[model samples]
Target: MIVATGDYHVLTDILVILERWTICHRRYHHCATSLRLKCTEL
Candidate 1:
């Protein structure tokens, strides 16, 4: 039972980390695109 609980916690932590990583990556991509567009305009 203890082993199962530990495994579950690990899985949850991994999922949370993956979600945060994906969100941050998307934000970075958006910021980069906007900066490129502004530079082109100038």
Candidate 2:
């Protein structure tokens, strides 16, 4: 993979953004599922 310094920084920024989104998405899904289960049980 040919990566210049500018491209590297851009890629790093994208990766960081993606990682943040993934963490938030997982947390949201987990909370939503848990709430659904609790509500169903109640």
Candidate 3:
């Protein structure tokens, strides 16, 4: 039971990290696209 609890905690941490990573990845992609468009216009 203790092991299961530990595993669950670890899983939650990993999920949180993955969620943050994806959020940052999306924002980076959006910023890159906007910058590219601006550069093209210039």
Candidate 4:
């Protein structure tokens, strides 16, 4: 039971990290696209 609990905690931590990374990546991608569009317009 103790081992299972430890594994669960590790999984939760990994999930949190992945979620943050995905959000940052999405925001960066969006900003890059917007910048590209503006450059093209110029």
Q: Using Cα atoms with residue i matched to residue i, what is each candidate's TM-score against the true structure?
A: 0.58, 0.57, 0.56, 0.55
Error of 4 at 25 (Å): 0.8
Cα displacement (angstroms), candidate 4, residue 13, comes to: 0.5
Q: Give candidate 4's TM-score.
A: 0.55
Measured by TM-score, the strongest candidate is 1
Candidate 2, superposed: residue stretches over 4 Å from native: 30-42
Residues 1-42 of candidate 3: C-alpha lDDT, one tens digit per residue: 356888999999889877766666655655776654543342
The clash count for each model shown is 0, 0, 0, 0
Give the range where candidate 4 is weakest over 10 consecutive residues by summed lDDT. Answer: 33-42
Candidate 2 lDDT for residue 21: 64
- Model 4 lDDT tens row, 1-42: 356888999998889877766666655655777654544342
Between candidates 2 and 4, the lDDT winner:
2
**Residue 25 lDDT (model 1):** 61
How well does candidate 1 score on lDDT at residue 42?
26
Question: What local lDDT does model 3 show for residue 36?
Answer: 43
Query: Per-residue alpha-carbon lDDT of model 2 for 1-42, expressed as tens digits?
Result: 888999999999889877766666655655777654544342
- How many clashes would you count in candidate 2? 0
